[model samples]
Target: MPVRHTDPPPAPSRAPSSVPETPARTRSQKVADSPSLMAIVAIAAVGVLLYTVFLFDFGHRGDWPAYLLVVVAESFIVVQALISLWTILSSGHDPRDYTFNEAQRALYGNQVEQTMAIGIGMRHAEMQLNDFPITVDVFITTYGEALADIRKTVEAAVAMDGAHTTYVLDDGKSAAVRDLARELGAEYVAREGNAHAKAGNVNHALSITTGDLFVILDADFVARPDFLHETVPFFADPTVAFVQTPQTYGNLRGLISRGAGYMQTVFYKFTQPGKNRFNAAFCVGTNVVFRRTAVMEIGGIWQESKSEDVWTSMKLHERGWRSIFIGTELAVGHTPETIETYTKQQLRWATGGFEILFRANPMGRGRALTLDQRLQYFGTATFYLVGIAPGLLLLVPPLQIYFGIAPISQDVPGLTWFFYYAGFYFMQIVVALFTIGSFRWETLLLATASFPIYVKAFANALLRRDQAWSVTGQKGVRNSPFTFIVPQVLAFVFLLATSVVGVWQAQLDRAFSLAVFWNILNTLVLGAFVVTALKESREIARASRELRALRRAGREPVGEHDEKVVTPVLPEPREERRAVAIKPVTPVPPPRPAIAATQAVAAVPRRHRAVAVRGPAPRPATRPTPLPPLRPAAPRPPAPVLPSQSGPPSISGPLPGLPIGGGPGRARRSAGGPRAAEEPEPRTAPVPVVPSPRRRSASGADLAAEVLSFSGDSFSGDAPARRRDRRSR
Candidate 1:
């Protein structure tokens, strides 16, 4: 007989559907497809037309109010741009005879001194470290994480070929990890209460473990085998308590990761070392080894805030403990895999670091930190505050484009612009070259894209609101619809509206045009962010739905799915016994030699059976070979099991008649056969069997079964009766 089978659902389409192009230019189309280049052209055309009209119709007005307005707006833009430039240029010290450019100076001028101090301090600290013996303790902290990923970190730490003790602080209290730690002969620590997140975890280890110095390693980090050997020798100075190495991620190659890492390298390797020459090396959160005594002297590591590292460093410095910045990359950790996670991490650090500045300015009050230390901490805190700068820039253009209000009044003398505005503008180019000239294009774009989000986040931080940390989700593929596209949409809309208004009002001039142009430029820069955000949101939503369905189907652990699952009320739980539906039979010749291949082929399509009881399912048998008691068939009168009544015909006879160790005929017989006979004589009624309402109370059993089935195909070979028996025994 010819066999038929349902084709498998077409694999989900990965290629995104193409967005339809805008047809002939409608009003909405013009708005949506508006480009920055187009905006610039439109604004320039309007400016020329307006100038010509003004000269002809209202030539040389007695007051020159419009002229004054243009001059005033330009003056303000020039001054603001210059001041910003000066801030960037003065922000870093040029210790190695390094030169600056305008953009670099504008970006970092204000931070130059602090960067220099830290660099000077780092150099001095390194000189002092030329002499102390150091033993390191590497602590890897973990919450609930995949065992494989955690194992990779553990292995890296354990492989460190030096006088270092490796400890895995399992926050999840996972026995598997503990066992693995034991196997690797590393210290295993599990805590049952508040360790208050990561800070508490590290502190708990500090109190218990005995190491000359402590090194914090995140669960996703991999320490070089020679990390301790290379870094420990630098702690020779009795005054030096710790040496912080840069946290690098060898595996991360995303544009965002590279951009952020480039900045870090500049700060830590170049700027920080210069600052260290003056005793101003500050503590970074991780990949740093701290002196046991120094930490203990400060009453153990501080857990007062989310940024415990900074808080602890403050107290340590107050007590005269010194820190140094080591330029080498000794340990590697996973960078934010997704933009969402990256942004979250940045926001947390920014907000928390700022809070430290507000609450504990080592240099501000009569605190113990020295001049250099205070400046270092202040610089660290100011990094976050800088996020507002771009937002301010963004607002400037919009204000000029929307309203003709110049932030700087035109009443000021024109020559002041030469010294203050001109000088600042020139310095900005210098600073940009010095700080981020290598990735000028990308950095500029990112800066522009980040403006809105940065503004919103900065405002949120000022309000002292809580922002939960989110991990970026990436699968070795750089793609996300929301983060990549939504910003573009918003930017397009803003640019189009502003451009049309500027043109209609005939108010386009150099100042007005520049404002409109910059805004449009910013929109393009942020386009990727919007698309990626949307895609991330959609993926999260889909995952949540799947989790909920699994929970409802009684195929997942209760609490595991509780976080994502949505449960609906049912009239009552039903005992649903459905036969395992096997896939269609594939013809094969009968042969003894092909038995092994046949078995393997058959295994691929075997259907695994599972029954969902209204309440709970019976527990599995403890003994391996013991069979469960047979459940008597229901005692109701025999009913007809015709082809249609049975739901569908199977080529094989009734499932009950098939052999427990059925052969190839079972496959052929089941292919589109007639339905079983549902009706039987009343005299031959089957025995009544009702499951006892009560069953195991544990909710995880069902989930555990499902997980096992999916993970290892454990249920594929069992018959329906055997599956029930296995569960009940």
Candidate 2:
């Protein structure tokens, strides 16, 4: 049965919608998807050998204490490097294998001949998996995020191409969020208390809705329409628990957001995909889809830890459920736009890692994890110890300068030390370059300055303290970067004073001490951090001042907006402003025998929309909201959607917010609302301009005579204008 936008009703026997099948990948194509893995491995192999040679070189041992510190610090780095190398080696494995392809084909089998119906009023893309209808519920977990931010996310979530219900799980308890959800045709969900923060909010939603798979998006995330289509097929396998996609960021222009985003980019690009081969791919909270049964099997999202996402993944793994991480970016959202948000985010994540390390060891007995998984999870648990290394290393130069304690003995020549240092550390930098394409100075700076946060997180975890974030954060009241970097400032002051003292000592001895040089380097790194923080603080202050001025002037900044109460329904793929689908290069001739001639010819291909409004629509809402303002013009009655004899076939649907002026037919409408017709108007007939009689020609008939003859009255020589017959094929 063919779906038609025409007035006729659809057949009850036909399935509502379908997904197109993806062709099977050949062996060569599969290999090509991961072409760079082998080069990375080859380089990493050489790097490991060089690292081992330098690490075990005992001939250059200094004072035993200093040597011990150096050994411990360097060892932490090398271990992480090699573990990351292992993960990157496994990154070549593609999750979309033959099994996923077969499932997609079955899901794609629904519509024999179809037209995808989508627009503002009704968004539905119903499909089948394993011949069973499945409902997917999208949960957009939001706290006190801006209303504008929430609207953009909900709009995209509802617009995503799949059969799903979009719910704004507003733990913020804002009435504005509710109104925004209503305005956008999404259901609003609110709860009394956010006990477990994000996890608790989602768990409550899961209880109310019985969807087979639930997609969790942060309040800021705007999902691409195919977000579900890309991840849902993996659920075709009974054992797979969840599918994780990369948390890509669109707000990386800011200093903090850029650094944070790049840091995550590396992991998403390399670490997560590799974890898939071990079946240890963990969820990062957002941009992930989970099977309801799998989440419920683990007693809902784990509430015992702030890092509920990781703990939930662990519990599922212990229950022998597999996880998959697709490296593709399915959604783009905001990263930490300010240092305050960044600090809190890192602290939360680091705390979770420490909690896992101390509380739930993946390698512990009575576990179901594989050896590959145990090592990977164990590595994750111990990963933040690397952060501890930076704190310890920062103190080494001060110790050497003030107390004559050195990690490297005077026996090691400066030239020899340089070779050994470059072998391990430089090789690591090279690996970073190969993996992420380039080294990010912002990432490095942030990482170096971030040890203080990690150490605090460790202490918080060790002491069994809960990290709390202020929910009462006032807009434009963000704290300065100084609030988060007190420790870094102290370290900078201490390192600077030590460097001065070391320089004085070196002058007296008439020697250029390497310890002094190293101390100066550390001081500069800390100084750079302090300088950047101060600069950011100034920028924040300026922005706050401007905001205050705006408030004083009684004008608040506008955020995301929507169309009026009634518009022809259309959900377009992600673009700048909403737009009509691009027209076909050649016009579609007309509906053939396959399509009923009564149906209007569609201008675009089938696309994802949630509930496509077809057949008889209910009476549209009577609220007569005015359309967007336009320049004054003579009133012309809106064209009927039906085929017209005078023009080409009328456009099938309202031209969605097209670049050209949207006609009266494209009234902005909410989902489920039919466009209300305009009040009857008497259209004034257009008068054809008569070209004034040209200057009298010198020939037989003057121009005025010719014009008079061309009118309805026949001329002396005239026959009716001949119609050129179109040739029949």
Candidate 3:
């Protein structure tokens, strides 16, 4: 019998930085060779050829049924190809150019500038290494994490290059960490209350330690030998507050983990450098050095908030201190080795980020924060909201498959769609290529697959009444379908059912056949996702079991020793220097007030005061008093009478109230003539005066009449009795 050979177990996935060397594709070579473009061309060619064949066959057989099916298939392929092409084209960025030397140089320079400002500053301070030999306190925070992981980190901290004392603040209360700490000659600080989770643990450490500087590390991370050598000197600067180092991962044993590491590199090595360039690099909750004075000044590490690092940093910045981001990845940490943990971590981050946006925007709070600080704070908090975009995009294709409802109309001719959609598709490819490169494609696809889940998680977090921090379970294990399986299964079932219904409909009518193909394709894609999810689920379960067993065995904990390390205590307020004040000089007398020049002005006021006049002083007569005016002088010779028409003399009595022109029975006036006058009769009419209501005499009545006659309108020359009669009427 022939010997049978079995395949060896797969090697654990290595970190991207550590991937075994493949033949390197040079920049020029990659640009010249385009596999994506070739695939697109091939797809387009097949589509056109199939359409041509269908067109000819339709002409020959006159069997529109077969021809229609071919046309539909051909159309779908062409449209899909064109869409892909268009996306690649419209992305506007050239992936090939992104990897070019010049682009790399720019990105490198940005990173250097960022790292230099923060990392160099810290390192330079460290170089001034004080032989003060102060005892420093180290806090390693753990939550539902495996003992082995905790042990690795604690052991690494113990090996730190300084006279440092370590403390393991285990929220899980695992004896493993306590024992490991004991073995490593470090202190194990366990807390009964885990109210704020990691923050609570760290604060507990703070209460017990008397160190001048606190080095905080997450349980999953191990410190480097030079961690203290590179960071401690930064505290020498009285103004230098806290120092933060980039988080780096070592082994990436899976595709997800590898992708996450790559993202971190780009973020820390590239984006972080840029941020640091502007003094905006923020803390990542681990590998941070805090000044004891500054921490205490702001009430120590904040435990009330979900994200303690951000909350504490905000307070520190508000209190007029500085933070630095050391570009060097000085400490080694672990990525989520499986997809479930990876997703869980991302979800928790997203939820926490949203919490900050809703609750912690410091803009309107009237704090004395710089514009740069505000932007940095807001940018850090709102970064996770970007996940909503991909979540929305995922729903689009699924909806298109399930219902024949396209978000955009697909009724355009095949050729029109070919160029338009192909260009759009090409644009996206370009953008992806430029931004993430090929290494991240799988991660992007997985992210796409989990988009809906992420969206739901975010929405649920928002709606839930209680906002509590739930640490992602990082122990590598595979479990049953209960965690991530049920959703996948349900999605698969729905997708499968839709596909079957689509195929049945296709058989009945050729027009609906395209719908059937679309549904079937959706089903296949969903099925792929379901398989991947199950695999990840199993891995998580296995890791969980391993972690539980390690806990039961009770391995030694890191940071278990009780030795106390003394650090430089900050100076008391009385010992601090105070500003000196100078004595005030005596003032000279002010200039004397100026005196007025004239007493003559004062004499004028005295004269005016002495000349008070009585009311109504007698009026002065101008020389001659006028005699009574002569009478009207004989009516001034009767004014000439104008000629009148002779027909019944036009009955001209006071001209009735007619205008100067004549109508049927009226006389007309000519423009040139002047004439008709009447004489004034008397100054006053004879008075038939009755006795006044007040019983006054006739002389008084006469005086009243004289006054009335002098007044116009009422009685200019008439009797007072007539005026009185008119008033009565």
Across residues 1-729, which tens digit of lDDT does each residue of candidate 2 receive? 011112211111323344433424432234324556567566766776676676577876777777788788778777887888888777767889887877666654443223343333213445446555556778887777777677778888887765577777766666566667767767666654556777767765654444567899988877876677778888777677899987777666766667777877557777887898899989988989997766655556777788889998998888778899886656777778777888888898899999998898887886688899898998888888887787788878777888878887788787887876776677667766666666778777787888899999999999999998532111335789999989999999998999999999999999978889988887887788788788889988998899889989989675322212221223211111222233433221111112121221142222211111111111121224422211124332332231111122332443222111111122232111122344221122333324333333334344334443334333323313311111111
Please provide, for model 3 over 148-198, each residue's C-alpha lDDT reduced to its tens digit, 9 standing for 90 to 100. Answer: 778878877776644455667666665555556667655655544455667
Once fitted onto the true fold, the runs of candidate 3 whose alpha carbons sit more than 4 angstroms away are: 1-135, 362-369, 401-404, 409-438, 464-478, 495-526, 536-729
> Against the true structure, whose TM-score is highest?
2
Candidate 2, residue 657: the lDDT equals 22
Across 523-576, the per-residue lDDT of candidate 1 in tens digits comes to 555655555456666777787788789989989643211121111111122122
- Which stretches of candidate 1 lie above 4 Å from their native place? 1-135, 408-437, 451-496, 503-512, 534-729
Task: Sort every candidate by TM-score, greatest first.
Answer: 2, 1, 3
lDDT of 1: 0.47
lDDT for each of the candidates?
A: 0.47, 0.64, 0.49
Q: Give the Cα error of residue 411 in candidate 3, in Å.
A: 8.3
**Shift in Å, residue 462, candidate 1:** 5.2
RMSD of candidate 3 to the truth, in angstroms, is 39.3
Lowest summed lDDT window (length 10), candidate 3? 610-619
The TM-score that candidate 3 achieves is 0.52
- Which predicted model would earn the best lDDT? 2
